[model samples]
Target chain A: MTGPRIALAVLWKDIRLDLRTRDRLGHMAVFSALVVVLLSIALPTPTAETRPWLPVLLWVVLLFASLLGLTRSLQTETEEGALAVLTLAPCDRGWVFLGKGAANLIALLGIEVWTAGLFSVFLGLAWGPALPEAIWAGLLGGVGLAALGTMLTTMATSARFREFLLPVLLFPLALPVLVIASRATAEALDGRSVPGLWWGALALYDWVFVVIPYLTFDYLLED
Target chain B: MSAVETQEVEKRYGPVRALRDVSFSVPEGTVTLVAGPNGAGKSTLLRILACLTRPTSGLIRILGRDPFRKDGPALRSELGWLGPEPGLYADLTVEENLAFVARLHGSDSGRVESVLEELGLAAMRHRRARTLSQGYRRRTGLARALLHQPRILLLDEPWNGLDEEASERLTKVLQRHRARGGTVLVAAHAVPAARELADQVLRLEQGVLRMLPGGPREETHG
Candidate 1:
């Protein structure tokens, strides 16, 4: 099969599996909701002084939730050794990585939207003024997180302590994404323009991650 | 020409050596049985040939091309491997699993239907894989392996969850594959039907390979 075709097949298959089982996506959604609820009850009312912290809190929630979903992204393949099918693809294994990463991006985007909605409803944070910039931040941030998380997740898939290994490997690498995304989001929430540098950094991070995984997936997928 | 060939293939896992200097070749249109005790590296050897695992040090050629090189992915398309696990998505139905594989191989849905019918899986095509019994799961796996009409088949303990009738059916399938000039390498403790149909027997003991006598080619190497 061609590279794009293989990727699409894998993408569709993963989407179908996720829909059928509702394991990874469902867990991430519920986890984010509970965290949001706890924060709403614990933190003081959303005042302008505290509102600046919302962007940070939102990014943190996104990071953890994305981590949650990323950790389980490959579970279906590992559960029954179905990853061999991917390793045996008729094209470069990178295509398989693309498909998996795209699926993860989709899942993360969904959670980002859901978390945003929860924040607005539970915390009374109005997003109307900065909706467009916030969305841009979310899109770029989602891509960065998805790219980095997917690669780390695959690297840790065969490890003995993968559940623990992913975060250890992910948190440090993901620090840049969190910082840039949160700052851009903070600016957007403040009704200010997001600097081009932040966008550039996020884009660069996403590009590096996506390219590295594509080049190395052939080895990563191997035994 | 040989369909599968390996020379001094060695696989090591940390301090443990799974396969040591294992070497043998199977001619085209023949069935070769690899017999060994558990942990004898039979599965490891098949995994290497399947391109799922790389040998720590060795040379392997499938259809006269090095599968670890740039041609690897293309070469893998012609190989059908079935390990202990069915390698299926349990949430998907049997047909969905097969269809996914077919798509991976750039095959059409017609091939999926064909394999389903051939394996007597059409009746349960819509049944979720998780709901199937062990035998049916294995059947579905076999159907997946055959869906792409590969030129070479590497099967590990394919007879394990099969009943008498299923075993007989598998024997027939292998016979037919060989009849069509396809190569088959099966690793198992013992399958009477496979033994009767085997063109050559390779014995692996402690990661060493020996070609048992009575085959057209005989070789013993450590």
Candidate 2:
């Protein structure tokens, strides 16, 4: 199979596996919802001053939930030794990274949508005109998260305490995506115009990470 | 021509060396059984030949091509590998697992059906791999590896979980593969059936490799 075709097969296989077991993606969505409820209970009512924190809090929850999705995404492959087959397949190893990233992107997007709907109802904030902007920021940020997370996941899979190590390694590297995404999302939620800088930074973060995984993933799988 | 060749290959993890000065060659259309005790580096050698790991400091080639280069995956496409782990997706049904592997090799579903039948897994085709017994799971892994009809097979401990019947079945399938001029390298502590099919047997111990006078049959049968 060609590179993209192999990637598509990987994506399809992951989707089917998710549909069957509902393991990683399901945990992410449910975890995000739980965080939303718990945080809402802990905080005071959403006043004009407190409402800004809502977007930051939402992104925070999504970010942590995304970590779960990323870590578990490769767990299945490792469990069955399937990564060996994937790496040895007659396509560039970068395609495996792309396939893994795309699958995580789809799973994270599901969580993103779920969190967005629930946060709106719980915080009583109207997306109004900012819904589109917020969505764009979320999507751009999701791409960055998935791309970097997949690379880090592959790196940590060979480690002893990968579950603990992935977040430690991922947070610093993923700082750009988080910072830009939070700022853009907060602006949209506040009904203020988001600066072009944050969007550009998010896109740039996505671009850098996407290219990096393509280049370094071969070594990561080299073992 | 040699189907696999490694010259003084070495694999070191920190201060410990897993493979040291390991050198061997398997002729095409033959089976070589790798015999060794625990920590003997049999798995490491097989992993290198399967293109799953690169040798630290030696020349290694599969089908006469450097497997650590850009076209490694292309070269590996013609080989099948079954590691110690079953490597079958637990969430996927037996048929799905075979089909998925076939797709990865750009083969058709017909191959998947044939392998399932060949491995006597057709009845359990719809069962999830996680729910299968150890023997069945091994069968599933074998089916996946053989689905593409690869020219070479790299198997690490193929006889681990098989019952007598399943083991016999696997030996027959492998004999048929060898009859078709496919090369096979199997790493195991004791594989009597494979020994019967093997033209060469190698022993690895403490990161070193040495040739045995006879096939593994001499070691196990008598």
Which candidate gets the maximum DockQ versus the true structure? 1
TM-score of 1: 0.97
Clashing pairs in 1: none
* Fraction of native contacts, model 2: 0.74
* Predicted model with the maximum lDDT: 1
How many collisions between residues are there in candidate 1? Answer: 0
What DockQ, on C-alphas, does every prediction get?
0.85, 0.75
The reply for model 2, stretches above 4 Å from the true place, is B212-222
DockQ, candidate 1, vs. native dimer? 0.85
User: What lDDT score belongs to each candidate, Candidate 1 first?
Assistant: 0.89, 0.85
Interface RMSD of 1: 0.7
Each candidate: fraction of true contacts kept? 0.84, 0.74
Please state the error at residue B215 of candidate 2 in Å: 9.2
Q: Write one digit per residue (lDDT tens) for candidate 2, span B1-222.
A: 789888999999889899998877788888888888999999998988887877889998788888888767788788899998887788999999888887778898799889988999999999998899999999999888888888999999999999999999999988888899998899877666876877778888888886642543353221
